[model samples]
Target: MAGTGICCASLEEPIALMKMGLSMVLIGHVNFLLGALVHGVVLRHINLHKQARAMEYAISNVVALTSGLVGIVVGILAIVLSKNKKSKGLTWSLFTVSLTAALMAAASAIGLSVITNECPFDPTRIYSTTLILWVPLIVTCVIQMVFSARCFAVCISFLGLPCCPNRKRTRPYGRAINVVRPLKGSRPISQY
Candidate 1:
C-alpha cells in the first residue's frame, strides 16, 4: 500500500505537466479552427466590394467583432472545463488580452476605412492614417509578445522546456530571409 501511494504521488506531477501541454495545444488548435470557420462564414455571407461604403465597412467590422468575441468565449469555456487552475488562468488571460487587442484593431480598421473612404480590405489606403493603422498593430504585437513570454515561462516551470515562439526567421547560409514577407508594404512593422 505504501509503495502504491508513493507511485501515485510520483505520477501526479507528470500528469499535471501533460495536462498543461495538452491545454496549450488544444487552445492553439481551437483558435485555428475558429479562424477557419470565421473565414468561411465571411466568404459565404459577406460581399467583397471593389469600393465599400462606410456602412458596408462598418457591417463587416461588426461581423468580425462578433465572431472574435464568440471564439474567445468558447476558448475560455474549454479551458476552464478541461485545464488545471494555473493553465485555466493562463488561457483566460490570453483570451482576454487577445479580445482587447482585437477590439482595438477593429476600431482602428473601421476608423481608417471611414476616413480614407477605402474598402476595409484595401491594402493601399489602410495606412493613410498612421495613428489609426499603427496603434492597434503595436498593441497586438505587444500582447503577442507578452503572451509568448508567459507561455514560455509557464512551460519552463511546469515541463522544464522553453516554449518556442511561433515566429521563425529563415536563414540561408549567413543571410537572414523573411519567408512571410508582405507583398504590399502597407502594414505597420513592429520592431522586437
Candidate 2:
C-alpha cells in the first residue's frame, strides 16, 4: 500500500477483496450450471437424431464450461491469498486467469450468436430454446467481465503500475517527448 497509487486504494482493502472473491465464485458457479444446461440441450438434440445446430453452440458451451472452472479455481485462490499478504506474482496470476475467463465468455457469446444466425431454422424450436437459455449466459458473462476489470485495477495497485491514461511520462515542460534527435543536429520536426 505504501508505493501503490490512490486509485485502487479501496480495492486493496481486505474486505473488498474478499467480497470480490466471493462474487467471482458465485458467478463461476452460475456459469457452470448454465453451461451444463445448454450443453445438455445440445446433447439431447443429438440423441434425437437432429443435426447439431451448426456445432457452434457446442463449441462455445464447452469453452464456457472450461472458463467457469477456471473462474472457480481463481476465485478460491483469491480468497485464500487475500487472507494473507499476497505476492505480486500470485496477484497477477489471478488477474490473468480472471481476464481470460472474461475473454472466453465474450467468445462464447459470439459463438452462440453465430450458431443462431448461421444455422438454418429448425421446425422443432431447438434454436429458440438454446437462444432463450443463452440470454442468462450473456448476462453472467458481462458480470464476469466487470469483475475481471476490477481485478485488473487491483493488480495495477498491487504491482505499483502506473494508471492507464497516465502511463506516459512527461518532459520538463509537461508534454511527452516521442521523437529522437542528435545532440549536435537541429531539433526533430516531430518534437515541435
Candidate 3:
C-alpha cells in the first residue's frame, strides 16, 4: 500500500518518486537482514531436536506461506489503485519482502547446521546416511535458492545498470541500429 502511494505520487513527479523508490529499496534490504537474524535465532533455539524439528519446520512453512499470501494481497491492492499499470513501487516492496524471506530461510539453514554439529546432508551420501540427514538440507537449499535468486535480481535491477545492451532501430527500412549508451567514466555501473 505504501508502494502504491509512492508510485502514484511518483507519476506526478519523477524525481520525488525516484527518491521514494530508492528509500523503499533500502528499507527492503534492511528488513531482509532482520529476517535473517530472526530466523537464525528461531532455528538455533527452537528447532534443534529431531521431533521438534518437524513441528518447527511446519510452523515456519506456514508463516512463509502466509507471507506469500500477504504479498499477493498487496499486489492486488496496488493493481487496483494503479488501474492495472505495472507498479514499480509495489514491485519494489514485494521484492524487498521476498528478499527478507529468503534471508530468513538461509539463516534457518545455517542455524540448523550449527545445532546439528554435522555437515548438512550430502545427496551422494543418501544411500549410506539417515533420512534425517537428507531431508533438511534438500528442503532448505531449494527454498533458499528460490528466494535468493529473486532478491539478487531485484538488487541488481535497482543498483546496477542494465548489462544487456539497449538497442534501437534507427529506421524501419534502414539496416542501421543504435545502442543507447550509458553515462560513462564516473563509476562502475554496479555502484549506481
Candidate 4:
C-alpha cells in the first residue's frame, strides 16, 4: 500500500479480486478434470526429437506450464489484496495476469490447431494420444477471458466513476448541496 497507487479507502475494492479468484478456480477445475488426456505420455520420450509429435507435445507442455506459473502469481496477488485490510487497484493486477494467461492460451491453441491438422494422428500408425483436454481447455480459456474482463468492468462500475450525476455531494468543510432551489413554503431559501 505504500508504493502502490491504489487507495483502498473504500469498501468495494476487493470485489474484482474475488471474481478473479473464481476465474482461477474454474481454470484449476478444468485442468484437474481433464488430466487424463495427458496422463499417458511418458517423460523420457518428450525429447526424442525423432517424432513429429514432439513439437505438439512441447507446445502443450509449454501452455500448461505457463498457465500454472501465471496462475500462481495471480492467486498470490488476489489473495494478498483481498485479505489485506487496505488494498487499492487490485483489479489492475488481476487484469494483467488474466490478460496474459488468455493471450498465452490463445497462442497455444493456434499452434495446437496447426499440429492437429498437419499430423495424421492414428493410434495404429503412430502412438497418438487422445486430445480430450482440447475442448475443456479452450472453453475455460474463453470463460477466463470473460471473467477477467468482468472483474474490470465491475471495478469500474462500482468505484471508478459516477454512473450518473450526483447532486447532493458533500466536501470536507462544506455541506452537500443537491437541491439548487428551496422547497416552496417549507423553509426559507437561506436555510436550504
Sum up the clashes in candidate 4: 0
lDDT tens string, model 3, 1-192?
345654344322344334443433433343334334434433334334545534544344335333334333333333332342356665566456556655555544443333343423332433233334424443543444343444334433443337522233244566776765666666655688
The superposed Cα distance between candidate 3 and the true structure at residue 136, in angstroms, equals 3.7
Task: Residues 1-192, candidate 4: write the lDDT tens digits.
Answer: 234322232223565455456456656456434433453443234453666666665666467546645654555555565666244566566657756765665554455445444443333313444455555555554554444444434434434446633333545478666866656778886675
In model 2, the clashing pairs are none
Whose lDDT is greatest here? 2
Separately for all candidates shown, the number of backbone clashes (residues 3 or more apart, or on different chains) is: 0, 0, 0, 0
The digit string of per-residue lDDT tens for model 2 on 14-78 reads: 76677678888998899889889887874445532354544555677888887778777667766
TM-score, one value per model:
0.27, 0.69, 0.32, 0.53
- Whole-model Cα lDDT of every candidate shown, in order: 0.40, 0.69, 0.42, 0.51
Q: What is the lDDT of residue 140 in candidate 4?
A: 55
Candidate 2 worst ten-residue window by lDDT: 163-172
- State the displacement of the C-alpha of residue 113, model 4, in Å, after optimal TM-score superposition: 3.9
Off by over 4 Å in 2: 1-9, 47-53, 118-121, 163-192
Write the residue-wise lDDT of candidate 1 on 1-112 in tens digits: 2444312322224443343334434433443343344344332343455334534544544443443343344334333433563564554554454455345434534442
On TM-score, the leading prediction is 2
Residue pairs that clash (backbone atoms under 3 angstroms), model 4: none
